[model samples]
Target: MNLKNLKGDVLELGTHKGGSTILFAKYLQNINDPRKIYAVDWFKGLPYSDEFGNTDEKKKAKGRLNDTSKEFVESKFKQFNVDDKIIVVDGLFEETLYEKLNDKVFSFVFIDCDLYKSAKFALEYIDNHLEKDGIVFLHDYSNFLNRPKYDWGIIKATDEYVREHKVQFTENPIAHFQKITSI
Candidate 1:
């Protein structure tokens, strides 16, 4: 992703351990781009799974991946010296997405919420604020090992959005959806 050409800031949902968030910040730093990256996450791990058929009981368990905290992610960012480029928002998507970032516009969004409802909400909410040439990266859209070992909510939510918006969707390991000005 060419962050230099993008107009608005970056938004990353589901930032666990700040891995991808740090990468984005470093890229922006290298490019001398002043755009800020907002990393939103509960930081408590996966919420209760949705009523998707592909989700298993283990995956459905709330707090399944609640090992990382906001402070841990912040420490990682500080270690990478990219803490200046990121703002970590701590809360559930339903509680924080709009309340905290409603006024911001995003040129790129990385969605890794790992659940249908979370992905769907992020997609719909970001669509209005995304730039015409904005890019959205959906993690786990193809699941692990390109097999159905995990929940298929990402794929289903992304497909539904693409179909509804008539936008282009590409799955090169991870799914990429670019916003089109005109269909």
Candidate 2:
């Protein structure tokens, strides 16, 4: 997607170590737009990793991927000089999403968390806030070919959400869903 043309404020569900957050901010900067990108995440890691499977591989990943901090993430924003264009909302998706971002309208949303519950909640939470015809970018939606046996919760959740809401989407690797009507 062309980040240069993204309208309204941005919203991201998984900030992780601020990689994508930095990129998003840089894109906005390149366009010389002063839009804010609300990057939301716990800054810790996945609440659970059991969604992958009941095998040892999944168990080994429990509490894994938790190497980040608000201070560290903020540092990246500062380094990129996009700190002023980013708002950090720290907490689990369930606890912080609506509470912190309900007031804003978004033209683009990036859902990077790869879990069923997280994906579902993120989509629903952004429903009222995403502007008409705004697009939602979903990661892990087309990972089936590479990680077939791994947790497919994200794919499942996204499929269900789109099907239930009759949302249309186009997918290459990332699935982009454009909001057509109120869900």
Best candidate according to TM-score? 1
- The C-alpha TM-scores of every prediction are 0.89, 0.86
Residues 1-183, model 2: lDDT tens digits? 344454569999989999999998898889788889999988888776646434566445446669998899999899889899999999999998777776788888999887766787888887788876788998866654565533446777777788887556876655788887853
C-alpha positional error of residue 27 in candidate 1 after TM-score superposition, expressed in Å: 1.6
**Top candidate when judged by lDDT against the true structure:** 1
Question: In model 2, which range of ten residues has the least summed lDDT?
Answer: 143-152
Q: Which whole-number lDDT from 0 to 100 does residue 10 have in model 1?
A: 91
Candidate 1 Cα deviation (angstroms), residue 49: 1.5
Q: For model 1, state the Cα shift of residue 146 in Å.
A: 5.6
Q: What is the overall TM-score of model 2 with all chains considered together?
A: 0.86
Model 2: which residue pairs collide?
A: none
Q: Which parts of model 1 are misplaced by more than 4 Å? A: 1-3, 53-59, 143-150
Error of 1 at 80 (Å): 1.1
Tell me the lDDT of candidate 2: 0.79
Query: Model 1: what TM-score?
Result: 0.89
